[model samples]
Target: MQKLLIIDDNDEVRRQLKWGLSKGGYELTFARDGVEGLNMFKKQEPSVVTLDLGLPPHENGVEEGLRCLGEMLRINPLSKIIVITGNEEHGAALKAVQGGAYDYYKKPIDLNELKIIIDRAMYLQTLEQENQDLRDSSVADCGIVGECGTMQEVFTLIDRVAASDVPVLITGESGTGKELVARAIHAKGPRADKDMVCINCGAIPENLLESELFGHEKGAFTGANRTVKGKVEYAEKGTLFLDEIGEMPMSLQVKLLRFLQEMVITRVGGRRDIEVDVRIIAATNVDIQEAMQNGTFREDLFYRIGVVNIVLPPLRDRGADIALLANYFLKRVSAGAGSRGKAFSPEALEYINGYDWPGNIRELENRVKRAVIMATGPQIEPDDLGINGGDVLRQRLHANDLSLKEARMLLERDMVEDALKRESGNIVKAAASIGVSRPTFYDLMKKHGVRNA
Candidate 1:
């Protein structure tokens, strides 16, 4: 249940508030003055607080209330304090809000209006709490890194669905850590004790795909000299990660659909049906909708595997995470090799932030690895990362012919990327250079999948 603390000097007003707000589903507590209010606030750690501007020490002024408000917020910076002031105390009310109160309410309180504000405050508090918890968990266990708001939503989703049996379909471009997400889900789930078998559906030959999924009996095929357990059998009571599931053959998809329906499988050239319990996690770089429309992927299989879709953003979309990941990879690649304390030069970092990473994290990691080994100096230069400043402009201009819309979008992306680089990845400076509000510039950066330095 939510907690609300009411700090007021008048007993009658506090009583009325407690009675009215009881129906709002919060556990109410009261304090008579600023000192008592801060004490109760520290003790209760309430989600929302109603602070009266006139306390006993400075009953006619806002100083005591404002001091209490600052102290309460210092204890828990996320606290939502709603300051209550007299009808004529507009300046004090506004000042209270400026002093870190979530909002301010004038006296002669209408219960309904105050209830609505309190409800919104509590909701916002809940969301921020959940987001922080998700971020903490992501840092500790997810093995994924990024602090973008969109990535926070993804982290929250992962935490919510990790323990369930529902199939998860991860859609993203290549090198976006889809496999890492799959492993994180399996690791955080109830089936972590069991094996998590993985197979690259696109890497195998069409003829061997079926046999690889389900076990084969001796003499089942031309070279079937001995019986062997397939990936599905090996992953009993665990998860089966189908990487590049969109590339799975339609004929094999039919068989997979049957297995999903019956929870049983048949070995090649074997009549007996073997029951298996395994969760499915499918990932694809291709658009499954287009695959289904083209009849290359079965609709039934798609539905069975795509119950919870977690779409991973490409590396370019993860703002500021580029520098974090680059620095992390730099330390790792240099530590094991001969180099020591290798780092990216300022020019290399600018190039990293400005360039569009078509190959995502894998590409970033590979370039960093090559640079660590190839760099003659302590710092890796842009040339070491295989990037040329002017060459980038030339390459963009001469690459495949683009439509007018595509060309405009490309130019927009480049401009934002350049702004971010020029500002040393400072969001405010970059947005100023673009002649747009900070939020609108952020939206554009997100739209163009631009990451900060």
Candidate 2:
């Protein structure tokens, strides 16, 4: 049953509302004045409140009633408030609506009509509460799974910066959960109620990247048939997350910087500038400083985006987070797939902990997902994960002892060898396939002393 609170100074009015609502399948509470009603509202947190403009001290006065409503909303903005006033006070009731009341009622309350209004308020309030609960629940889901000092510091940073609108630059290795941190930030921010737009800067070609960010007018380009609103525009009063921002082209960087400074943008091929209010959070796997030095990235844009910086630790550096994350992923994937519960075997946990996750949390998630799908028994084993196969150093270690340096070298060598083999000894193709530039790939080859095949 919904809880309904009625506040009115008239003895007969309060008694009648309580009797009618109680019979209408509601748990009703009454307050004889604005002050008493506010106290009850704080204590009960009722789903719907019927507020009376008239009270003992300021009977039928709009001033005290508006104050009470404002205070109630401050405490719980979701509270459905319906203002009650006299037929002569109809103007005051309209003022109440302007002041944020959900609905208003006039003198000589019809028991049946009033009940119907309160019922609707109760239903709407229930829906809003459920929506807010789901949003809060999502924040808990995005929490970083780790006990390491580095992860704890990251958590602290997230909590400290989530309430502000400052631009956040997250730098970390691929698969280190930069996007997760971004989501946590959005989920806790003032704009949590709005949408969060995530764009992958490296995925789009340079020609289309600007159009994607600033939108395009119809016929702006060959493929443009319809006028489109870009991610930045769509995320008004919300957050826009630019992932892999280091890959954003220099030309687009200037436009982006202009937008950040002016809080506005001109659509592609359009003359008018549209204003947008949005918070930006960017992330990248590459060294932005190196990109800046190479003239591939703009130095001015770098300082503009990195107002607050958060560096996520790799999964290998997070120690026991490996197993914690594994179990968390297993449970989620199992539940999502509607399969029976699955768990990791002792041997599997040992192998997971021993592994230096070059791909970080992302690789760990993939391994766990694959194990859950392939496992014939309830417990996933070391062999279920492809990492434990071949001559991987992690497979050679005992559960209690593992070497990080050897694991990293073995992982890097395996990646380079696989990329080279896949590309048939084409250096450019190999580098692109492994997400590195040709020059970087050549340096890695020299560092590892691997001659070109």
- Alpha-carbon RMSD, each predicted model: 15.7, 18.5
Candidate 1 lDDT by residue in tens digits, 1-453? 989999999999988898898888899999999989888998999999999989988898878888898899899988899999998789988887877899999889999999999999998787567445545635446668667777778877777778899999999999988998898888889999998999999999999988899989999999999988889999999999999999998889999999988989998978889999998999999999999999999988988989999999988778788877787677667657855456677657766865678899899999998878767756777667875444444354586634465466567778888999999999999999989889988766654446675
**TM-score, every prediction:** 0.58, 0.57
lDDT of model 2, residue 373:
83
TM-score of 2: 0.57
Candidate 2 residue lDDT tens string, 1-453: 778888988899877776666678878899988889999999999999998887668784678888899899899999999998887888888888987899999878899898889888987787577545544533355756766788778888888899999999999999998999999999988999999999999999998888889999999989899999999999999999999999998888999999999999999989999999999999999999899889998988989999899999878877766777787777668768988656776656756776788999899889888878877756776656766432445355444344675566557767887899898999999999999999999866644435567
lDDT of model 1 at position 272? 88
The global C-alpha lDDT for each of the candidates, from Candidate 1 onward, is 0.84, 0.83
The candidate that wins on lDDT is 1
The lowest-lDDT stretch of 10 consecutive residues in candidate 1 is 388-397
